[model samples]
Target: MIMSHLPYLISAYGITLLTVLALWLTTYRRFHQAKNKLDIMKKLNHET
Candidate 1:
């Protein structure tokens, strides 16, 4: 019964978890990069 489909279930859950984690890491990196760029731009503007 359920035992027959156990492997399929486990793989599906593993794929979904990996996708969510990759997306989170990408978003986190992009956010910090954008913040750093913004800070640099502000400093340049202040210098003028």
Candidate 2:
């Protein structure tokens, strides 16, 4: 019955959410690191 499949559907939804969150965290970390490097470079350029 369709009602019996509710647990499977819920599990799938949880897995999908975890995957998306992991991907987002990885992307955010890379973006922050890149921004940090840019800031350092800008500071160095101004000093010269």
**How does each model score on TM-score?**
0.86, 0.87
lDDT comparing candidate 2 with the true structure: 0.99
Q: Write the per-residue lDDT of candidate 2 for residues 1-48, one digit (tens) a residue.
A: 998999999999999999999999999999999999999999999999
Q: Poorest 10 consecutive residues of model 2 by lDDT?
A: 1-10
The lDDT, on a scale of 0 to 1, for candidate 1 is 0.99
Candidate 2 regions exceeding 4 Å error are none
Per-residue error at 38 for model 1, in Å?
A: 0.5
* Tens digit per residue, CA lDDT, model 1, 1-48: 999999999999999999999999999999999999999999999999
* Superposed model 1: Cα runs more than 4 Å off: none
Clash pairs (backbone) in predicted model 1: none
